[model samples]
Target: MSSDLWSFSLSTYAQPGVEPACLQLQSAGINVCLLLCGLWLGERGVAFNEHRLQQLRSVAEPWDAEVVRPLRALRVNWKVVAADDGELNALREQVKALELEAERHLLVRLERTALSWPQGEATDLSAWLNGVAAGAAHLDRDALHQLRVAVTGT
Candidate 1:
């Protein structure tokens, strides 16, 4: 497994049900980038703390809110029109790629945020997931658990 958050998120997201689970979490106002960063840190044995959690959130929230989501919304919205317009469909595809790139950049930013933080503390993946999900008002517990198992085999 790659130590970088982008690679980690890419691979984890390929696992079954992870995408829908992520969207479910995101719809509840959770920052998926931060959630993935929390998982990456947990896998790397970084200790969980409120300060660093907030640090990651501070860096990620705006990017996800302002850039990634809009690109995503536009792309998703184009599904109807794209089904009929070839040019529009091509543009939508480009938007989808751009949206992915945006998320990758956000993940990189998150990784950078944690770069200065010390490691060597073991944090449970489940606990980390819960902590990240704490701010989400409508999170589905089963989906979260399923996503956990899909990624961590736990």
Candidate 2:
């Protein structure tokens, strides 16, 4: 797996079951970008410190709420008419690309925030997710485990 956040996210999301799992988590109002970052950190063996996580959240939350979420919503909304309207479908695909680019920017922001942290101690994937999610009840444990397994190749 690629070590960088952007590459790791792309590769992981491409894994079987991971896209649906991520969408499931996203539909439940959890931040998929943060979740992806957490997985990347865990994979890279970053220190997983609380301060680092807080920094990540602070950098990500507002942008995610204001920017990424809107693009995602717009794209998802288009699905209703995308099948019938070719023009709308094309627009929706453009929105999808914008949403992905927005996520890439978020990952870049996250990468910058965690740049100083040492990848010294390997952390358990589940523990890392739990920390980043702060025990969000909406998250699906089974899907999360599947994602973890997919990313870890275990």
Candidate 3:
């Protein structure tokens, strides 16, 4: 297992079905970065609680709303138009990169927030996943299961 949240996220994302699962969850208004962080916390055996869930959300929601989403919106908006325009395509690619970087930063922030939390106190992975996913509308259970199975093999 990776030692840090960012590395864990990259490793998990590379697993089969994980990318699509994450995308599905994201499309349902779930924050993929937060989901990944919850997975990492579970993998590390960190205890889950409402306060910790809110703490992570506090760090993730704003950055995602203000930074990541805008870049992603621009990139997605340009996708079809950029298909025929090389210049716009290049800019769209840059926006994609920026969106990824923003997510990376959000992961870093989440890791920092969770760093001081004790680990190995809980092994209920579902608790962490559910806690992180709780408030989202139209939560995709299949996607969440795919993510859990892909990462934890459970």
lDDT winner: 3
**Candidate 1 per-residue C-alpha lDDT over 1-154 given as tens digits, one digit per residue, 9 for 90 to 100:** 5678999998888898899988888889888888888888877778887888888888887998899989989999999989999999999999999998998999999999899777767757766788888957878998788777876688
Tell me the tens digit of each residue's lDDT in model 3 across 28-125.
89999999999999989999999999999999999999999999999999999999999999999999998999999999999999999999998778
TM-score of each: 0.92, 0.91, 0.98
Query: Per-residue alpha-carbon lDDT of model 2 for 59-97, expressed as tens digits?
Result: 999999899989988998889889899999999999999
**Ten residues in sequence with the least summed lDDT for candidate 1:** 118-127
Candidate 3, residue 145: Cα displacement in angstroms equals 0.8
Local distance difference test scores for all models? 0.85, 0.84, 0.92
User: Could you say which candidate leads in TM-score?
Assistant: 3
Identify the runs in model 2 with alpha carbons over 4 angstroms from their true place.
Answer: none
Ranking of all candidate structures by their TM-score, best first: 3, 1, 2
lDDT (C-alpha) at residue 73 in model 1: 91
Superposed by TM-score, candidate 1 places the C-alpha of residue 73 at a distance from the truth, in angstroms, of 1.9
lDDT for 71 (candidate 3): 92
